[model samples]
Target: MLKNVAVALVDGVTPFEFGIFCEVFGIDRGDQGLPVYDFAVCAAEEGPLTMADVGFTITPPFGLERLEEADLICLPADRRAPVRDDYPEPFLDVLRRAVDRGARVLSVCSGAFVLGAAGLLDGRRCTTHWLHAPALIRRYPAALVDPDVLYVDEGPVITAAGTASGIDACLHVVRQAHGAEVANTIARRMVVPPHRDGGQAQYIQRPLPRTACDTVGEVIGWTARHLDEEITVEQLAERAHMSPRTFARRFLQETGTTPYQWVLRQRVLLAQELLESTDDTVDAIAGRSGFGNAAALRHHFLRTLGTTPNAFRRAFRGPRAVA
Candidate 1:
């Protein structure tokens, strides 16, 4: 029954993240058999609103009234200037009322700050851009800031980390409300991966050189090709021609996660593929994905994905799937 999605934009909002919300939920993609969203751009105030470095202003059709009818309301990131004690009380009131009415609320990047200021995020698990997470936590200790994951879906509220992950979270919402098929079609249209494992740290300002010579692309490619084998941090370090400590530092800088964590995600991804596409048994899939056994695979999958392999496969490929 969910249809109308209202996005609340404020001054100095990050254009790309705001645009992603519109693209994912606002577009009328009914031609592809996708459900259409009754999308509207609403502002906390009336009149012209300036975007960052865009040299133009956008006039939103609805004001705070948009929140009253919104099935889902999105708060896009804004600059740090708006968080002072005197900031935007009327907007906060609207958000509080919308949430009270059981409308789903979402925030991308530092828009988490706005929700936090409104007290909507208190005692809730949330995430934001890693660069702003620590400060956000310090400013509002009541919020459970998790700077690690791409997004967290806690019942009626969802918060996505950083900018691009906003797309990932929005796609996830599509996947949840509709299904994976619809989400995948949208992702294909956008030319982005349907999912990116781990969190925003994995995509931050990587310390590795952008050029091939100074990067970990080759080594990572090699690791992916050999996930069935026992791989260790030391072995990966040797492959990169660096000591374990240095490699660990650089790996986190490049991938925003430890080598082991990266391997785990890839291994799970391989397991998921096997579950969906092959008639492999759970034991066989686990062995091929480097989980050693079915039990091990089940543990990690349930821990990270919140579902057992069997249930996930059944939901994706159908009940007849061997998982």
Candidate 2:
């Protein structure tokens, strides 16, 4: 039902989140029979806009006028930085008009700040980069900010956490409007996994560990490859040639979480992928994902994913297991 999609660009737009909007809506896949969106890369400003980094200049085809014609409006990360007080008033005005006219709106990552600035996110379930979550909540007490989730679809306004989560949010919109078959096809064409487990916090780049300089990184890579193995901090410390206390602190510094928590999160991610793409039973998936048993898998799954494995599989693959 969506025919027109417009992405609003301004000074300081993040290239990656902006790309998510373009890739999802701008591409014409008529030969492949995908539903088409009349995508327009428009600008609040009349001329060329500068990005955060040098060497990238975006020239928008339409002006603020495009906002009225848009069925869906995507606000990618803006340069105004999440904690800033002031932004271009004209840009905020355009966003306000689009929402007042019934266009579905989406904001990826810190773009939620833009929406918040426009007053569109008041009393809405929204998310932003986890690092900015506390600030957003503190600044705008009306917004319900959930930092632990991948994306939140609150009626006509959807907000995604971080940059790459924008991809998942867009694919989710396609899936809801079209179906999983079409969404999966688009994802395959893009050479990206159709869905990601957990939120962006899991992928947020952390400063590397200082103490376990020799082997911590290697251990992380190894743990990823051998997720099915029973691993412990002592074992990992031995591998890193550091004492347990030092390894734990350094690991937390490097990954932004305790080592055990990191491993559990990664295992959950692995299980999520298997659930989406394979016909493995819950018990089998539990074993393969290093959860040891179905009960343990269910405990972590509910705590982290907010759904049971069976429920997630059902949502992704329908009534029966994929064969």
Candidate 3:
């Protein structure tokens, strides 16, 4: 149903954020049996649009009029749009009209500010880059902002957190519009993960210890390659040449999560990959992903992703999987 797509660009547009939309929606991937969107980049007024910090400008062939017919409108991060009170009114008006007509809107990072300006984020659960989440909430107090997660989907409006999370949000849209197969295909071609767990918390950098030891880091690599085995803190401690308490402490300090939690998350990620890529039975996937059985896998899946495996498969597989 999402056949037509448009990226609404303004002055000071961040190239990476804008490129995210173009890579996801603008490319012609028909040869891969994927949906080819009628994509366009539209400028608010006309003429050359300036890029942020890149010392360059681009001429968008389409204007605001093109947005009226788009099934989806993407607003990429623009540094000025979020902070400036005088962002173009015509652009905001068109955004409101497009959503009023039942077209979905997606915002990557600070672009949520554009939706906030249009009053589209009011009464909707949304998010932006964690650094800007407080400002977004302060400006639009009516908006429910969750700063921890990578993205939030509030029906008509989808908002993604900083930077790379835009890929997850765009792939989610593709998965919803087409199927997991198409989304997975696109992800494979792009050489990125089809799904990512956890939140921007993991992305926040912390100063590393000045010491020359990275025992926990090596253990983490080993754990990833051996997810299917029953891994205990004692076993990992022995591997890391530390006591159980020390290993647990080091793991948390380095990974921001306990060893058990890290392993469980990895298991869930493996299960998700298997579910999306293979026709293996639930029990088989559970065994392979270290859940041991279908019931355990179901419990973890429900707790982590808030959906049953069968329902997730149905949503992604669409009509291709036999009931």
TM-score leader: 2
Give the residue spans of candidate 3 off by over 4 A: 205-323
Tens digits of lDDT, candidate 1, 15-111: 9988999899988999888999889999876568888777888889889887889989998888753354444789898888888888888899888
Residue-wise lDDT of candidate 3 within 84-201, one digit each (tens)?
6766789899999988899999999999999998999999999899888878988999999988679899988999999889999999999999999999999998899899756664
Off by over 4 Å in 1: 81-85, 204-323
TM-score of 2: 0.66
Best by lDDT: 3
How well is each residue in 202-232 modelled by candidate 2, as lDDT tens digits? 3343333344454778888878888899999
Judged by whole-model lDDT over C-alpha atoms, candidate 2 comes out at 0.83
- Report the candidate with higher TM-score, 2 versus 3: 2
Candidate 1 Cα RMSD after full superposition onto the native fold (Å): 9.6
lDDT of each: 0.82, 0.83, 0.86
Screening candidate 2 with a backbone cut-off below 3 angstroms (N, C-alpha, C), the clashing residue pairs are none
Which of 1 and 2 is the better model by lDDT?
A: 2
In model 1, what are the clashing residue pairs, if there are any?
none
Q: In model 3, how large is the Cα lDDT of residue 57?
A: 96
Q: Which stretches of candidate 2 lie over 4 Å from their true place?
A: 204-298, 305-323
Clashes of each: 0, 0, 0
**Where's the lowest-lDDT run of ten residues in candidate 1?**
202-211
